[model samples]
Target: MKKIHHAEASSYFIEAKDNEAFHDQRLWDLRQKRDREAAVIPEFQELRNLASQIKEHTLTHLAEYLEQFEAKAQANGVTVHWALDAAEHNRIVYDLLTDHSVRTLVKSKSMLTEECELRPFLERRGIEVIETDLGERIQQLDNEPPSHIVVPAVHKLRGDVAKVFARTLDTDPDNDDPNYLSEQMRVKTRHFFVDAEAGMTGGNFAVAETGGVVVCTNEGNADLSANVPPLFIASVGIEKLVPRLDDLAVFIRLLSRSALGSPITQYTSHFRAPRKSGEMHIILVDNGRSERLGMEEFWYSLKCIRCGACMNTCPVYRRSGGLSYGAVYSGPIGIILNPTHDMRKYSSLPFASTLNGSCTHVCPVKINIHEQIYGWRRVLAKHNQLPFVKKAAMKVAGKILSDPQKYRKTIDVADAAIEHLPRFLLYSRMNAWGRQREVPAPPDQTFHAWYLKNREGKQ
Candidate 1:
C-alpha cells in the first residue's frame, strides 16, 4: 500500500465535503450510539480513573515489569525478543521467518506491526503476508493507510470496497451486497490460512504477571490467524502491560464500549503459550515510545487502548477526517503522537483543533489532550519551529496588549473601523473562522465609554 502523505490526507477532508450529508449523519448516529452505551455504565469514569492509574503506575516501573513479563513468557515456552526500534523489530521478525523457512504469513490487526511496516518488509524478503481483518484487507486492496485505528477502512464506503474487491479478488461488481463480498473474501482468505506458516497479532493487554498476551477482535480473525499457523508471532508496544489478569476486565469493559459501541468485543483471546506445540514468539517494540514516555505532558498518550473513541468524539476529527492528521494514529491521539515522531511533519495538527476539550472528555484514559497540545505549542516555540508569520503576529499582539496606551488606541481604531469594515477583511484568507461565520461587528460604544456614562457620580 502506498503510504498516504500529509498532503493527500488533507485532501481527503476536502473531498469528503463534496459527498452527500448522509455520510456525516451516519457518523453522528454511530457516535451517539457509542455515547449512549458509555453513559449506561455507572462506573465508566471510575473505571477510566482506575485504568489510568494502573497504566501510570505500570509505566513508572516499566523496566521491572517488563523483566518480569519476559521471565514469565519464557517460562511458558514462548520465545521473546526485544526490539529497540521499528527497523530492529522488522528484521527480527523477518529473520525468524527466514530461519523457519516460512513462505507466507497471515496476520490479525496489529498497529505495532503497521508502525513497523512489517508486511512490506517481509514481502521484500520474499515472504507474502496477508492481512486477515476485513477492514485491513480493504485497505490492503486500496493501497492506502488505515483511516481509523480500529476500523482500518472506516473512510471507505461499501461501493469503494466493492470496487477494490472487484479488482483485487475478482468479485462481481454487480453484487454489492456486503454478505456476498464478505463470503467471497472468506473463501479467498481461507487459502492463506491453510498455506501460511505464521500468524501475526497485536497485543491488547499483556499480563505482566503471567506473560499472557490478550487479543480482542470482533471477527475472531486473531484466533484463526494464531491457530491456523504453526508459528504465532505477537508484537506489542512495551506499555501495553497490566500487573495482573483481573485488571483485564476494567480495560476490556472500557475498550470495546468506547471503540465500536459494543459492551465487549465478540472475541477476546488470551494466549499464554504456543498452541499444540506450535512455536510462539513475542516481540516488544519500543519505536520512539520510550522517548515519549519520558515526556511528562505527553506520556498519558501511552495509556490509549487504540479504541479510537477520542477520534470519533472529536469535532475537528469528524470534519477534517482521520487522514488530515497524517499519521498512523489520527485524531487527538495522532496530534500528540505525530509530533513526537517528527514535529516538523505534523506541525499543523496541534493548531488544527478548537481546544474544545471534547477529545479529553471522551478519552477512556483521562489524558489531558488539550493541555498537551498547548504544551506542544510551547515546545515548538522553544525549538523555534513555529511559523514566522504566526510568531511575528503574536509578538506584535503582545506588545500592543502590554502597553495600556497602545491597547486603548488599537481598541478605539478597531471600534472606528468596525463601522466601515470590509466583508472580505472579516471573512477571508486571514482566518477560517470568518469563512464559516459572520464576525460580529464591534460594539458601537467601548466598555470604558459605557462605564463612564453609567457611573455618573459613583466613583
Candidate 2:
C-alpha cells in the first residue's frame, strides 16, 4: 500500500469534515441523549469501573485466556490459528483460501482485516474480495482507507458514492438518493453472498469461558457472511477477549449506544462453532498487542470497544479529522496503539491530539487516553524523537525555569519581547500556537516589577 504524506492526508481530512458533518451532527444529538441517560443510571459509572478492572485482569493473564480460548474453540470444531504480526495474519488467511481454492470472499466490516490490508493482499494473489458493509464497500471501490473505523466511508458524501457506483456498477450518476444507491448496492452485493466461497468477519468479543466469538453489526452482514459460506474465517485482535458470556451484556449495552447512539445493533451473532458440516477458522492476531501490554501506563488502551464515541467527542479529532492520525485505528485509541506498533511509522499520531481528555471521559470502558498520550510523549522524547529546535528550546526553558534568578530574568526578557514583537514574527510558521489563533499582547509590567516599585517602600 502507498503511504499518504501528511499534506495529502490533510486534504482528505478536510474532505472528510465536509462529508461527515451531517451524520456527525445527528450522532452528536444522539450522543447527548445517551450521555444524559448514562448519567441518570446509578450503576453506569460502577459498570465502567468494573469493565476496566475486568479488562486489566484479562490483559494481565492474556496468555492463559488465549490458550483456554483456542483449546475450547478447537474442541468445539473451530480451527484456531495464531499470527505474531500483520504479515503473518494476512498470509494465514490467504493460505486458507488458496487451499480451499476459493476465489471470491465476502467480508463484513473488520478493522482488523483493514489493519492487515487483507483485501489488497488477497487481490494481489488473484482472489476477488468484496467488502459487504455499505461504508466499507464504498471505500473499497474508491481505493481509500477507512477514515473512521465504525463509519468507514464517513469521509464520503452520497454524491461521492454515487459517482463511484456509477463508474463501477454502471448506475445513473444523476440519482444520488441514498435509498436508490443502497438498493443498487444490495443488488450488486447479493451475488457475492451466494457465489462467494468464503466469508470473513472481525470478532467483536471472544469469550474466554465459552470459546465463542461475538460480532455486532447493524446491517446483519456478519450473520449472513458467517452462515452463507462453507468456509468462514474471523480475524480478530488478541485483546478482544471477555472472561465469560454474561459479561457481553454489559459491553453490548454500552457499545452500540456509544458508537452510533443506537439502543442496540440490529444483529449481534455469537459463533460458538462453525456450520455443522463446514469449516470455521479463527485467526488470533497479536501484531504488537503484547508489546503494548508490556507498557504499564499505556496498556489500558486494549480495552477499547471500537465504539468511536471517543472520536466523536474529541475536539482534536473533530477538527483535525481521522486521517491526521495516520493509522487504521484513529482518535484516542489510535494514538496509543499506533505508537506501540512502530513509533517511527506513527510518530505523528500521539502529538496530533490536544490532550483534552474528552476521549477518556466518553470511553465505555474508561481507558485513560490523555494520560497515555502524555506517557507516549515522554517515551518518544526519551528515544530522541524530538526535533532539534524543540529540544534546544525546551532545554533553555528548563534551565531558566529551574532557577529563581534565571526565571525572573527570563520573565523580564519575555515582557520586553512581547512589547516589541513584530506581527510577522508572532504569526510565523515556526510557532504552532500562532498557526491557529492570535497570542495576546503582554501587560505593561510584570507583577514582581509593579510590586517592587509600589509596595517595597511601604513595607
Candidate 3:
C-alpha cells in the first residue's frame, strides 16, 4: 500500500488561496465559539470528566452492556446485528437490504456508514443510495469524501457549491445565496424521503438501558430518515453505547457545545423502536473498535462522540483539510485511529501534527489526542512503519543526542550551514521547511556557546 503523503496531498488544499483562507478562519471561528460557550457553562469540564469516566466504565464492561442492549432492543421489536469488521458490516447491510427488497435507500449523515464504505458497496450491486444531509449530499454529488466531520463541504466556498449544484442539481450557477442553495437542496431531496424503500442513520449515542438510539442533528434529516421509511436502519459503532439513559445527559450537554458551540442541536431524536407497523434494525459494528479498545496507549480514543471538536480546534487540520488524512475519520483523532487499521497505508499520518495539544484541550472527551499522536509516532518508528528517510534521520538524531560531544558538533555544523549556505542550496526542493519559509538566520551566538560563556563550564 502507498503511504498517505499528507504534505503532498495537503499542498493542493493549501495552494487554493481562497479555500484555504476560508477553511482556516471558519474553523478557528468555531473554536472561538466553543470557548465562549464552554466558559458560560460552569459544569462543562465536570461533564467532560463524567462522560469520560462513564465511557471508560462502559468499555470495560462492554460485553455485559452489549448483551443487555441486544436483549432490550430485541424486546422492543428491533432486530440487532453485530459486525466484527468493515466487510461484515457491509455484508450485513447488503443482505438486509436485499432480504427486504430495498431498491433505493435514503440515509442521514452517518460517519459509521462512511467508514464501512456502505454507499459504494450497495451502489455496485445496483442499489441506489441517496445522501440526505446537506453537507453529505453536496460531497456525494461532488464525489469527494467529507473535508470536515460536522461541516463536510467546509472547504468549498459558496461559488464552488453553486458550481457543483449547477452541474448536478441544475440550479442557477449565478444564484449563490446560502438560503437559495439550501432550498434547492431541500427541494431536490424531498422526494427521496417519501420514495425511498429504506432509510438509514448512525446513532450519536446508544442507550443500553432503554435500547434507544439517539441522533442529534441541526437539520432534521435523520428524523425523516428514521421515521419516513417503512424499513429503518441505524448503523452504530459499538463504542457509542452508554450504560443507562441518565448517562446521556453528560454527553448531550458536551456534544453540541464542543462541536458547533450551540446549546443543543435543533433535533435530538431518540429512536427506541420502529415506526408503528414498520420494521427497524440496528447494527452494532465493531470494525476494528474492539482491537482499539484492547490497545494500551490508544483505547481511550473510543470515548469520542463524533462531535468534531478536535477538528475545529486543530490548526493542522484547519490548514491541511480533512481529505489530507485519507481516512474516514480525520484530524487529530484520525492520526491515531487510521494507523491501527492499516499501518503501512497510514504511517505518515501520525507525523502530520504539531503536537500543540489544542485538539486534546478542546476535545469534550479529553482524548489526550496530541499525546496519542506522539505515541503513534514512537510505535510507528518501533514497528519500522515510518518513511525510510524519516527513519534514517531519526536514527541519526538518536545517535547524536546520546553523546554530548557529537550533539554539540552537530549543532555547530547546523549553525554554520544556516549562516553560510547559499539560497539556492538552502531553499531547494529537498528542504521542505524552506518551501513556505526561509530558515531563520543563525543566532548572534549559539545558545550552547552563550551558556558556556556565562557558566564558565561549571559542569
Highest lDDT model number = 3
Q: Give a tens-digit lDDT track for model 1, residues 367-398.
A: 88888888888898988877676677667767
What's the CA error at residue 275 for candidate 3, in Å? 1.8
Candidate 2: the clashing residue pairs are: none
Q: Which residue ranges in model 3 land beyond 4 Å of their true spot? A: 408-430, 443-459
- Every model: Cα RMSD to truth: 3.0, 2.8, 2.7
Per-residue lDDT tens digits of candidate 2, residues 1-459?
233244346556556566557545644675686687576667878778877888888888899999999989999999999999999999999999999999999999999998898888889989999999999899899888887888877656789899999999999998999999999999999999999999999999999989999999989999889899899999989999988887878888788877876678899899989897889999999988888788878888888888888877776665556766677888778888877777767766667777888888878899988889889989889998765655666776667668889667656555555643332233323356655577777777778888988999898
Clashing pairs in 1: none
Model 3 residue 272 CA deviation in Å: 0.7
Model 3 C-alpha lDDT versus the unseen true structure: 0.89
Q: What is the TM-score of each candidate against the true structure?
A: 0.92, 0.92, 0.94
Ten contiguous residues minimizing lDDT sum, candidate 2: 421-430
Candidate 2 ranges with C-alpha deviation above 4 Å: 1-12, 15-17, 20-27, 410-415, 419-436
Give the number of the best model, judged by TM-score.
Answer: 3
The clash count of every prediction, one per candidate, is 0, 0, 0
